[model samples]
Target chain A: MSISDSTILSVQDVSISYLAHRGKVRAVSRVSFDLHQGESLALIGESGCGKSTLNLGIIRLLPKTGRIDQGKILYTTRDGRVVDVLGLSEREMREFRWAECAMVFQAALNSLNPVIRVRDMVYDTAQAHGRHDRVQIRKRMLELFRRVRLDPERVFNAYPHELSGGMRQRVLLALGVLLNPQVVILDEPTTAVDILTQRTILEVLRELRAAMGFSIIFISHDLSIAAEMADTVATMYAGEIVEIGPVEELFYRPRHAYTLGLLEAVPKLSVGAQELVSIPGSPPDLIEPPPGCKFHPRCPFVTERCRREPPPLVEEAPGHRVACFESARVLAHSQPVR
Target chain B: MEATTSPQAVQSGWAAFWKATRRALTGYTARTLLQGLLTIWAVMTFTFVLIRQMPSNPVQIEAERIVREELVSYEEAYSRAASLFDFDPNQPIIEQYVEYLAKLIRLDFGQSITSAGTPVLDQILQYLPWTVFSVGLGLLISFTIGIFVGMAMAYWRGGILDNVVTALASILFGIPNYIIALLIILILGVQLKLFSVAEALGRVDPTIEPGFTPEYIGSVLSHAILPVVTYVSATVGGWILTMKSSTIATLGEEYVTVAQARGLSQWRVLTAYVGRNAMLPLVTRLAISIGFVVGGSVIIEDIYRYRGLGKFLTTAIVARDYTSMQGVFLVIAVSVVVANMLADVLYGALDPRVRVGKEQ
Candidate 1:
């Protein structure tokens, strides 16, 4: 609600859409969030929930068909200068990207150019931002690689295919922070690796964030990861942020039915022998979604008014917001699992 | 203990040698080389047997021609034809095969049958350079231009460039090289009056002496224009289409997006990321095309009356010059085989994924 001086990236009424054959599919609609300096925000949602689109929209790396329909992505530079990312010229945007804000994409296995060596990619990223000193870049890269637990020299010289899935992810993470970007957007960084490797990546990410002090906005379907890595968590459903707050506040005192459904769907360790409750029906079609509340067809607390009108996002608690008419009832019904 | 160990050491040494030899024989490069060599030999033998079985023997065909043209007696024509040609029609096929095989081992193609004592190797060497220069230049020009045009088309897909070039490339790709050459001659030479067909015939003008002089080079290029144009029109289509699809696929690759997200210059991403990867699949295709450069375009060269290796081949086949045909076939087979081997090596060098015997 209130923007502080430390707020690095603020997405105000952002909307993204893909021009499809049938019609324009609104992928992300009016998604607003503030990512403060050194704070990690995780956008949690099911598949096709536009979690990835919002993050990609911030960096302006959407596919050809995908476009930012409306939004003001305000990025604060280190000098406290507010620059509209949408307003930056192509040339300025190129310099702004990776230098000001970098994104570690999904599918780490395919993230790197297979033909190129890691060191060349490192130099390329640095040189693109006008950092021409090779020795300094190399030294910084080697340090980052070491911090990520990779054999610095070996990984530096090796091709993308030469490294394992986890290694590539780490290399990408290290590369993502190489430019010392104030904001790093990670989209499902741990999805393609094994469990142990996932743990390592998380630890490395934490260490990097701690050491470098950069704000992170990560997209994850894994609730545990969202719980562990995120300082602030935003629950996205049907292209809209339904609930968002402090990690503990959102997870424990979920004020939206969709968020409650998500938390209940996950099989809890403490609550043994309980049946996992999956939300009935699939996600609504974006082209011609149901009128009024998009979640009403699937929401348990759907009232007569729900089908006729959409609920505006309102603050249910200090620094916590939810978009539901029956937020108090939903919060009262939510039982703490841990 | 020393005596016992000595015998064991000798056995191990022999085992190690055998292992090394087996490894060399079965390794990727060695296997590819061996297969290529075998393929060449197979093609050579097939062509040798096949060309011989075509219609009539050189001596008999020549004798018939002499009798019909000069109104000579059959016996006189036969004797003259037999004497004129270095071929002995009475010689057993088995004996001829054995002799040919023996000479082939020594890398000697023997004398030309039609030209009598002229060495087949010398004739081929004289004609080879013109073909290589013309065809090689055509391919280089087409490939380079196609790559840029194709990438541009892909980048601006659905735009006017993509739509126009796609249709044009498809149409050009469908037409045969010889037909294209004839069309160039008909449309450009006769209808359009772009260049005189008579002047364009052969590799160079008779007055232009062989040198690195501007006049000589100019004359050579002028003569080469028709065949080179034909080659470019016919093959550029294939390159453009191939490169377009490859660029499209490479553009969709995650690395390309990542490269952009890294704030890389558009040129760097296009070259190092998109262009390099897109060009990989085409590299082998290009290498194979290079192999055919040695063979030259027989029909296209003949149509243009260009004195390249292909024209030489047409002459040899017309005269039933067995030795000359065999010599040309051998050269073609060797070049193709060598080019394939080079493709494998070059592919390995360009792409580290297929680099043989490297750490896995």
Candidate 2:
């Protein structure tokens, strides 16, 4: 199970805390994962479940009050040097950010500089990182537009608002992979797009990622999309990754009680809902999460052990990891939902 | 719809010429210009009617002057007064208004009834630029400084610098410009003796010949300093607070985050992304602010004893200078309309989103 040939980065016990008005809210707690080169890791969870935080945290794009409270983010450079992302100076981080890893932000189509042309927005990002050869940049930009199945001339000169949501999402995709980065973190890139546009974005991203051979941290709340797009799936609850495994292993043989409850909650196609079980409560109170297993209060199979102490994420199968005390009992009793 | 994109079609220059002409005639620029002209005409017409209704003592003043100095009979004085305005006392107010409009079209604001024989147009020309110079310079200083300070405050939102700036903005907004002008004169003119209460009064010193010399220009600027400072200080707070709040909102936008994530330097992100977006509303406001330069700082001019249009307006009212009042009001109204039009056109150059070619 050790990372080999494609290992690009490892998020080791990285905890992130945000200074909200109410109090300190731990958005991501001691989350750990290995991101293999050219592999896609789908970070799936309900809303406010730290999936987005993990993406932002990996790129060091946390807001003004958000801080990495503990642990190292060991990022593998293009040249295969492992540098602690947290330990690097801001200046060094700047060089490493887009050149090595970039993110296609969530609901970002509307956020395109409404005043700037699509081409200029991409150029600005390219030029900001000291790429001065305009002709080369333009040539590459046109090529990228083509790769995304967009005509550069038709859309390039037009301001962002002039384009449809689908076109705008493609532009964002182009910008994210502009430098052919080794790693791409997509935070809900399909959140605001129509279904047709979502399929197009997925196709373009899959094609581009295949051609470039880049690792991706795909963060989404939709379990169906994650099941389809990601190689490995990490289920997050109450700011912690409660279960991590290959998509099939997690979906079919969910060992964690939260994962079992989550899989059961999703409505399957070609079938009518008889009793589609739902998670009992909303996402845990971030400011004052329940003690021990943060999910214990809302957990369906809550035992005394779950309320007393937090269970460590331990490997239950060859490639599956779970953090529930009753994972074994739940896995035996819970039927496969998908 | 500009659907033709074939390179050969554009090679002849005919298509280009046609497009350019079409854009000018049927696009946003032409539409906005029409709107601006309509607005200005409406303002001029409204002011024309309103000024005539204002209480005027000009006929009384002229009649009294004839009786006291010329030793004329009261009846003779009355006839002389009635004839001077070219209006019959028995005619309706609307009839007088129509007559006034006819003369206004001919560019004849009849000679000031109270001042006798001096043209209202000439007096307006003499005082208008002084007000423009003071108010325009004041607006420029305040807008630039306020925007910069506001941006910095937003960047350092919770810091001590932000608190200090917020407090200062509150003080500026709370106090009126005239009060600030009074304080400046009372303190700087009376106590500190930084500038003379007398020297800083009027457009220029009485002794200097009104010529295009360095000395005359220097004297004119010295007179403007106090009023300009007061106007800028009083108005700057709103600009700062608006810009700060707008920038704060912009900083949280997903684009800003995406911009930063793309490895842009913090400075580049701040100016090109965050600052540019935050400034769109302020750009329109800047145009409005410049328009007010023509409005003049009436109370500030009064406090400083400066001879600008605002002061001229006050004098015209007291002496019942009807033509002069009408002339000044028309100028202010026209300038404000023109300023708004300029802003609408400027939007084409500033924000690309609004530069949409033709109306749907």
Candidate 3:
């Protein structure tokens, strides 16, 4: 509803599903969000919560089984033209990808062709978009590689197998923004690397974001990473946004039982050795989910109303939304400040 | 000078020399080549010993044939056979082996027992080129067609192309080369009257000079068509199936998806990403196949009446000409060994992860 001139990507009521032998698996159900220019929005959730599926839907790069059943992904081009990505023809979509929006995949190690040199892949990306200036592409790629803190020349000429995991991740990140796209979607960029490498990647990402000024849709299960990298956080439960707000507000004053439970589950450094409370039971099956509020089965503050009816996403504050019947109770228990 | 150079120093120098020699002998490429040569020798020796163990020697076999057909006495038949043959049947087997080994060391295959004064090496050389031409052409055509069709099948997997080709390729793969040759001759040549079977016999037209002229080349190709078709039909299915599976696996790789996500053209993705990666495992297979080109298909060549190395091998075996058979077998053994070495080297070149002599 908060559509503005600054908004780069407006995803409206996006619902995606995957066809299976049993039935259709509703991966993401009527999800909606706005990503403003230069803003980093993190979609945080447990595995199989449709975080990745939703992002894949945005690029229209879903698997053969997956379909964006309903949604309009309105993208604002640099020339001030708004294009519905879903309506773009195959040729136009090919042109739009990486030139307007790029995705840095989860498996960074396997995201590059092993037989090909890094420079060739860069050339390939450029050539695909009708950019034939190899010298210009190389110079720009080398510069981007340097920004990502890689040995630019070595990495540029080297094959993917020659580079380490962290280096490959950085190479992919550099390659992602080589076209200077308006949006970059990163799906767990640091998951494959060591802790030190993860720290380096985060730093490099922050620096790159500051320099390039592109909006980001960061998907991760690591709350700490989400907190560090995201300006706004959206907690997903059973393929729906259970709670979404500014990072600080969501961390401090969570208005959803699932959000509060997720925070409680994470081991706090300050409260060393305190028994970490965990949310009981697994995520509900999207194929045939439990009726009413999907989280009610595992929610601590479950009520009769919560089980009987699914709560719609409603604004609890000026900028915060929660889909829980017991928002007031969750908000009260969320504060750790004594 | 002796005082300055201590005994320990001289000893150490000799030790270093020996260490260098040891390293050279044990190095990967050197080791591989040595193993290949040893394999060739072993196969040659085994064939040599095995063929002599056959029921009849060349002299006795020839004599019996003469006696059966000409109504001559056994003593008269034996004298006639002895006079016709260049080989000495009375020589001890051990002495013959030693003489063969000695001549082989100098690359001499000796004279053919059945073919009077013709050297086995000369006859092999004459017949080898025809087999190479036919089999090589077949393999090349088969490989190319298989790669494209297989890749196409994989890219559009589960489609009509996929379903039909999968069934067809599997069927073709199961059929033997000789059977395919017979089928071609029977169905196309004899039954269909597509081409005259008599004209297809032999490697080239007797009237045409074996040169690069259009007429000569045309005749050569015309003659080679039947045998080549047989080779392609027999082997193409294997290549197609292998490439299809390889390409399918490659298409599933994350990098392929990433390549498409990068907005690469479908053609580019097919060739550079999917095709190149998929073709990696096939390079070794192709090299091994190339090795077998020299050995050729004996039955297929015989059926087509193509005068190839395989045909020569068949005739030598029939005549009980040990020297000629040994020569042909040696060529096959050498080619197979060399091809295996090429496979290893080719694989290293294609896949940088397994590049030779780099990893400890």
| Best of the candidates, TM-score | 1
lDDT of 1 by residue, B44-104 (tens): 7888888888887788778888999999998999899999987887788778888998998
Please compute DockQ, using alpha carbons, for every candidate against the native two-chain complex: 0.88, 0.60, 0.80
Off by over 4 Å in 2: A1-5, A270-273, A335-338, B1-37, B63-92, B106-110, B356-360
Candidate that beats the other on TM-score, 1 or 2, i.e. the better one: 1
What DockQ does predicted model 2 obtain?
0.60
Error of 2 at A197 (Å): 1.6
Q: Which residue window of length 10 is worst by lDDT in model 2 chain B? A: B82-91
Categorize the docking of model 3.
medium
Taking the tens digit of each residue's C-alpha lDDT, what string does model 1 give over A1-338?
Answer: 33579899999999999999999999999988889999999999899999988887887889999999897999888997888899999999999899889999998999999889999999999999988999999999999999999999999999999999999999999999999999999999999999999999999999999999999998999999999999999999899999999999999899999999999999988778899889999999999888888999999999988899998999879989999998877888896554
State each model's CA lDDT, in order: 0.91, 0.83, 0.91
- What clash pairs does model 2 have? A6-A37
Off by over 4 Å in 3: A336-338, B6-13, B207-209, B358-360
Candidate 1, residue B247: the lDDT equals 99
**In DockQ terms, which candidate is top?**
1
Q: For model 3, how does the per-residue alpha-carbon lDDT over A113-176 read when each residue is reduced to its tens digit? A: 9888899999999999999999999999999998989999999999899999999999999999
